[model samples]
Target: MNSFPVTKFYDSGKVHTTDTYYELLQLIDTKNIAFEVPKMGQKLPFDSVLGVQVLNVDSKASDNNDASIVLKAKYGKVSFLLTGDADVAIENTMLPKYDLKSTYLKAGHHGSNTSSSSNFINEVYPMGTVLSYGKDNSYGHPHKEVVSRLTTVKSKIYSTAVSGDVTVTTNGQAHSVSAKAWTPPTTTPTPPSAGTTGKLQVVKKDLSTEIVSIQNVGTTDVAMAGWKLVSVQGNQSFTFPTYTLKAGANVHVTSGPNAKSGGNYLKWTTANIWLNSGDPAKLYDSKGALIHEVK
Candidate 1:
């Protein structure tokens, strides 16, 4: 199945330095891998990264959500946030969710001024940040102000243009980093606004076959009791005798089946709209409930 990777990058609260769609295609060509690129608002495949669930590729972009992708791959909490050339407004809203002191961040938008806010730097507290760019390329990558911000926070920095393929390896407990042509710079960037909202968990999971989990993203608190589960086979609907949850509430449903064997599929729905199922499942809010089944 073809998948879209941009939605994930955008939702994670970082700017896109290059056309990621084009880059993925290039990767496929260079590596001779068979892959398909889906339309916007799609979800990528999910796998266990360092013991945590990670869907590296997916499309979940929409009018209500920003363009970013957040990866929680265990290895000591490293986030590769792509903002797609967004300005300071976007960065300010995103820096607070993760641990700045320990997290590893990917510099936003080729090091543009529109990004890299002071408030963002304080929250990311990244152990080391990477700037992906080309040597002496056009956009004047590694912007001076952006660099200054890093220095202010005393964050170890690396540049892809100089370092070649910057790679960060983590074991969910500790991290080991190495880069080619990477050189530490001594400059920083001007600070920008602290975004509206800090960070949020977009995807959630559980064992209940009927209802996996609940997700509420908007400012208003949406109820979950009204939502029902739809089976993947025959598109059947299983009504919830009694289930009520407000927005930002993570409720787990113990009234569903476990999707252990193949051929069994289901989704959560509210009225005619589907909340957790199919592609949108990746963006489940779940408030914070543990949705699973019992033996």
Candidate 2:
């Protein structure tokens, strides 16, 4: 079995949105893969197998929307940065905060101009920059401006979108890197393309009022209408029952003495809202407005 230490840092002070990482760990728990957590920005034990940390600086508010952390590691004279999706502004703030004399950099934010600032590039002075992106991606990532900037700094560029997986091995001050492509199984199942359709429902409640939301989860658009409230948190759910709903719509109802103050709560709270009274409360949308509500 192989063991490694891993740590993650976030510039934005919020938990991540996905759990796919945890799922991967579960698969390797008893396999040939093992890991531990080492302190951030510090060296591993002399006999250690792996060390991980994040580069987050400044007295910025902690939010998930901020850029990703600036990761650094060293083994002898060779050091590496496994930058996730860090943008330019965050890079500008971070470069001055750390000793970033790295041999390699996992180029920030998929080679977007929003990162890879001139000042940040000079600070890193990376021997090479790695770009990980999907080929023919809809977003047209790895913008030309970013690539040209890296060239002006004379940084060698490698890419996953073109060359595939890049692996680096370091032994003290000496290091080497290699690349290989990852291919899916021949029998792999293909999922549906974009523009499919699914249904989703959201519900929010408080002592003063309750709110309900319905939405589309499918690839296709869904409309809002015909939703109702069937339950509540306060003691007056039964007496103040008059809910209205429409097909392909979301219905939100606020009941009880606290209903008046509910709108203010809606403006700032991260609470979920539902517009119906059912055990498996389902919501359907035939229009594309639900995404707007979410943002």
Candidate 3:
């Protein structure tokens, strides 16, 4: 006896097979197998313990649209939407057809611009949005516009690129998100000294542009060569490039475009080096000694 893998298609008359399908057919002894065509508004008969619903499944839509499946799982009042690579078209079609509000949402198309429309996101109003994409992916998953839209909705966004293997636990009334792999940075911070360590203080921090200004408040000039500014959350560091800070002078370090080494500005070159919710900025000397830190 030979075993055959059974699959389902939307249209029974239009079923087609590929080369791999033909190879599998040859290995199976069964001459004919039936495929099930799920109805448009069909709901899976799962046990009452797990509340899962299939909201929409339109096979007449285009190839990408046809393959899309919008599913919502409910545990009492808490709900989750697990959308697989569904584009904006699929989302728009489902918006008015179903109740999309959920506690958690897996961002469509891995946060691609083709999906996660502002209208769709607003309709869902998820508390947390998770972008399931690889780190440094070639296609640049989680596009900035999508992220901005999610941010506008005040959604806590988590990306596999930054925090790996995120886990969410809920008891129907409340939910908490955590990543076991991510750990907060622990450092023995040094307090600001008046004149000994050059009195470096973080005068201002612009979270939007990741720009941090460190001022020398001491009476003597501070040799800034080999000094570093580090973010405690991400451990992102910016090293001074052979410059000297005179007394009462401030140097700006930006983590984005417009990097210049002139009168008072330096650039970190990397994007999003600082946490928006405020992280500790520690300044270290050339010998890896912590000189000053600002929270």
Best by TM-score: 3
* Per-residue lDDT value at 164 in model 3: 83
lDDT of 2 by residue, 207-247 (tens): 22344343333444432222222322110111111222233
Better of 1 and 2 by lDDT: 2
Runs in model 3 with CA error above 4 Å?
1-37, 180-295
Tens-place lDDT digits, model 1, residues 1-295: 1454332222332223224435655665665665443333233454445323222223443311234333333333455443444445545544443333336667666676556777777776676787776676423567678888888887778887776777777656566678743444435433222222212232344322334444444355443332334332112333332233344655443332232211222323322222232323322112323232121
By lDDT, the best candidate is 3
Lowest summed lDDT across 10 adjacent residues in model 1 is found at: 191-200
CA lDDT scores, all candidates in order: 0.45, 0.49, 0.70
Candidate numbers, best lDDT first, in rank order: 3, 2, 1
C-alpha displacement of 73 in model 1, angstroms?
A: 4.1
Candidates 2 and 3 compared: the better one by lDDT is 3
Model 2, which residues run further than 4 Å from truth? 1-13, 16-53, 57-67, 180-295
| Candidate 3, position 272, lDDT | 51
TM-scores of the models, in the order given: 0.42, 0.48, 0.50
